[model samples]
Target chain A: MTVATSDRAPAPAAPDGASRPTPRAPRRRPRRGTVARYAVLCLMVVLLAGPLLWQLSLSLKGAGDTLYERPPRLIPTDPTLTNFTDVLDRVPVLRYVGNSALVALMAVVGNIVGATLAGYALARLRFRGRGIATGVFVAALLVPIETVIVSQFLVVRSLGLTDTLLGVVLPGAVAALNVLLMRNAFAGLPDELEEAAVIDGANAWQRFLRICVPQVTGVITVVAIFAFVGAWNDFLWPLIVLSSEESYTLTVGLNRLRGTFYDDPRLIAAGTVIALIPIITFFVLLQRFFFRGLESGGIKG
Target chain B: MSSSTDLAVRERAAAPRRPRAAGARATHRWRFVPWLMLLPGLAVVITFIVLPFGNTLRLAFTDATLLRPGRWVGLENFERLLGDDRFLTALLNSSLYVVCVVPFMMLLPLVLATLVSRPGRLMGFFRTSIYMPVVMSSVVVGLIWTSMLDRRGLVNETLATFGAIAEPVPFLTDRWLLLFSAMFVTVWMGLGYYMVIYLAALANIDGTLYDAAAMDGAGVVRTFLSVTMPGVRSTMALIGVLSSVAAFRVFGEVYVLTGGTGGVGGRNLTMTMLIQREGTGLQAQTGYAGAISLVMFVVLGALLVVQLWLQQREGRTR
Candidate 1:
């Protein structure tokens, strides 16, 4: 695939001897353009991240502090974690975090295992109805979850999984996007790798497990993060299925906080921050893999 | 060089391999492996997606409720939908939202992607920062923007400070403003997500194309139109369809922003919101909700078909 070549090829080619000597000066006016580009980028960042930063500032403010002060403060003058403490005191913050963690963990495991297996089969193996299976998945990608939510809820209820973390986790367990992404990743691998294994008397499963799956670690990581973040951030489905407080994920829990702490914007902000931290942390830590995976999975697929 | 060498090795290996008998035997034996691998996933999809989807179609004809089994009354629910004022408002609102959001979601991201497509030290940070909102939950985004759009919120405060308005605008309370505000937030949240996709598409365009364009004395707009635009056209079309579908099905953001009441006079009520209200609200019109979902499905299905046709045409021409 072009993605495989573009992702890997450009980095090493940049330092060619012919192009290295005059890097600072080509036909372009480099200094002015660079400054303008940086200026535009900085403005874009501020505009994009400003509200989130404001949310952070709000979370840090004292409860009595008005958010609508004449000139809004980007920084809290009297910074405190009282809102955080208040949110914890008012609600089962730890319990909600635990529930979110469990759901996201289950979703991550389920997506990685399910998507990998199915994707590997779709991409590499010849089987009955392979074309139909691929077609079903591609079609499923277009079916918005919201459109099917009511019947999905009924189906979950029929299965007796309502108000449970499993109810929240089950429907999202095998995202079609992840399956397709994994399939693309597998398809991009050099056929030689698998053929080499096959010629050595490796079974189909053995070749897939040892040789194929290992090569797509990048895509796997991407799928895991997407699944994790998706589960963590999901609101509507979890809201519909999980009715009780104990079973509520962080998103649901935070929504409840909005009702309970409606008068206290600071506490709500604190709850928002709590809900945001984990996925943001995941994104920050795996930022490289996340972007690379998105590039390959998104464009090629 | 290594790929050629590997091809040679593969050819040599295949040439020395056993004849058709063993190959046929192996193929027969391995035929079930793919099915085995696919079973669990297919089971999930069938149970959660396929079954529910079929059931939704079934439920739409009946008067289903949470507490009661449906009694099929064919076309009644759809007929009711035709006269349901809330359903009509929702349809109009949803269409308006799609019209407002889809173009911005498409064009803004393309512009941003082009601007930041070049690699540099800080480009990574810029890309990530812009993308940060996309990674956050819709609930959190809703919360953040809800507060920001408050009468005493930062948005109005900034505007007032600049003397742009005489009074605080009712962003969340006023119907048109609320829709616009929601659209703005949706675009903001989506900018980086779509930009990343565009950037990836941009990476595939050979840099030498730009060099060639420059050699022909094409200015910025000319080069972009001739080279960059054509290069990302398929991706743009894909994003257009995806974003429109998303717009048509918008719920969480509006739900959170309006605190789940569909805002004043149901002015900003989207079709998904109507479905949620019907299925789960006090009246519990589950069958009606199903009918609405079917309508949405039809709309989305039509879009998908158009997109596929466009893609096919693009392929054939190429």
Candidate 2:
């Protein structure tokens, strides 16, 4: 909320001297609008969070409470964490969590390295075929992932990477959006910063690391978050690639909860809650960087 | 700095030489860098994106199967698609989903942006609440919605208590209602992300315009129509195109909700599911699926181009 105030500096300042007298004359008018705005926002908050809260409440219920419906209760008459325990016992929840974490970490590392290098090359270096390359990358953005699924499956099988964590992580490691984001962030850096380093006898790699990388740290964080979430939440590719239950990611594991539906409603709700945790954590951690990066990038130029 | 001075003196000293040649050499050097930057990403795109696209294009023209190999059938797959009733149903369902959802997705975010633009105390909370679902995995969101919209789920239970219905509605399984339910879930999940994009654009707006409009005695609605809307028109255009593409390409919701059966008389089926079922069904028809995908690609590609074209026009208009 404090962030809103920082943004407000430009708001009042934009009116300046011409409207200075007007504000004094009608200070109450702005307050009225502000109050109305807050009311609308409060409604939106309920709309957004209401369902999620319902899910949380359901997850806390005992199995009997879920099925006993003259009407479904918002708050269970008798609550239990036994459902969470049941889910933990029936499925390899911890292993799936580890697999998701491993895949996300590898993808994030791969994307950051590959995108930063590509971003720097596009942003700094002068070379032949630059325009053509940029054009191709932009055009590639619309290539639907579904169109390539079969071929990608074949490609992975041929490489003998199928069913391995690497198969899922590798294909997603370098994305056009990340490269584009990094390039835009790098472009905003002053030329003098790079030139000054070049005069000091820094090589291309050194200049990128010492001068440009620091400047685009915010974009790097944004790209990493995107890559991590993309890998973490992905299901179709992992489902296609991984054959064994021991190797299944959280999404595959959660999907299996559908198989166990008749077992217990408590377990089902518990599993649903468990599946949402990493996603919620991932977003909360990265949103600070995400918002800051977009502000700095100027809405994709 | 010293080397730059030396280089400047050398360049000045070499002014009599082939200066045009030096400038051209530098330009050529600069050109290679972008290609270098593009190489790894291009390789990924080529392998993961272009090669598959090429294969799908070729496969569309052939009689391919998961087993028994493939032969060049030359438009037979596409010809079959034209007459296929299920394909038409899927097409209609997907089209309706996009049409129904895009307006809500686009408008709600704009409304949200307008509300949050006032520099309120809870604006961050508002932005975060909306965006929470965007960052969540589609699969998890699908699972969550499944629970929330189940017959005995919270939504129906809530409606039942209010006596909105005599009985709990078959929200997911009902033929007439399934697609709407899915669209509602999709919009609920996506609203926050588009809001962030709108907020970003709103942040860039010059605040003086609002005061100017106020001085002219325009109220909130008038100011929003004439000032705020135009100010963020480009972002709105971008979000519109992105959300439409998202709506068209939606698979997770349909897959999870209807389990690729397309629910009640195949009414909830989408093009992506049809493509999946064809490629991977019990009786695998890779060539037919490939053909369907090609049609989808062409339709989407044309729409995307139109979207960009409209965005450019709108941007210029603003």
* Highest TM-score against the true fold, candidate: 1
- Provide the lDDT at A256 for model 1: 73
Worst 10 residues of 1 chain A by lDDT: A5-14
Q: Write the per-residue lDDT of candidate 2 for residues B183-250, one digit (tens) a residue.
A: 88799888877777787788788878877887787776788899888888777777777787778877
Judge candidate 2 at residue A117 and give its lDDT: 86
Candidate 1 docking band: acceptable
What tens-digit string does per-residue lDDT give for candidate 2 at A127-244?
Answer: 4465776676676666777776766766676688878999888677788777777878788887667655655666566677887899888778878877787788887788777878
Give residue B80's error in model 2 in angstroms.
Answer: 0.8
Model 1 lDDT tens row, A1-301: 2223223322213223232222322345434444555567677888888887888999999755667776787888889998898888889978988998999999999999999999998987654578999988877777777778888888888899989999899988988888888899899997778778655667667777899999999789888887887888888888888888888888877777768887767878888888778878878887786677667655321
Residue pairs with colliding backbones in model 1 are none
Of candidate 2 chain B, the 10-residue stretch with the lowest lDDT total is B1-10
**Candidate 2: deviation at residue A288, Å?**
1.4
Tell me candidate 2's fraction of native contacts, as a decimal between 0 and 1: 0.43
CA RMSD of each candidate after superposition: 6.1, 4.9
Query: How good is model 1 by TM-score?
Result: 0.89
